[model samples]
Target: LPFWNKGSHSPSNHVIVAFEAYRQLSQVSIRPMTAISSMANIHEDICATAKRKEAAVIILPFHKHQSLDGSLNNTRNDFRWVNKRVLMLSWNFC
Candidate 1:
């Protein structure tokens, strides 16, 4: 297991960006929890950030069963077998 670095700014930055992007969901009249695309982008950003820092990042891909299992299976598969420091928050949906 890789150590968690509290000093990392990437994760926190990703969180803030995610909040801002998702917050627009309400404004667009989109269904709650239906913004899987946005969430996926956020996950990718988080993963990329973690990869750049060589740190472990936990990712719970949104809509695990509906979106993740189908659309994100490839990315998840790649992450699973890769040697990078990362962790899948859940498999086959949360």
Candidate 2:
């Protein structure tokens, strides 16, 4: 969260960069919603955002990645758990 401070950015600015790319590629308007809550409560925030926005779908980044060497790493198990909770709680995905 320190990266969000002035003179800094979100973890090397990847979040901003990704959202900008999405904004460019998407036909509809898209904005990044950041929730400053504990991981345990992240799913709630996600669901709330979707509901307020009347969004039909909620897309979350996968917690895992495959490297060029075919190694499966960079996994955030907490995010995977949160994603499951989001899909479980959000009726649209149900």
Q: For this target, which candidate reaches the highest TM-score against the unseen true structure?
A: 2
Which structure among the candidates has the greatest lDDT?
A: 2
- TM-scores of the models, in the order given: 0.22, 0.61
The CA lDDT at 74 in model 1 is: 41
lDDT of every predicted structure (CA atoms): 0.41, 0.73
For model 2, the stretches where C-alpha displacement exceeds 4 angstroms are 1-27, 92-94
Q: What lDDT does model 2 reach?
A: 0.73
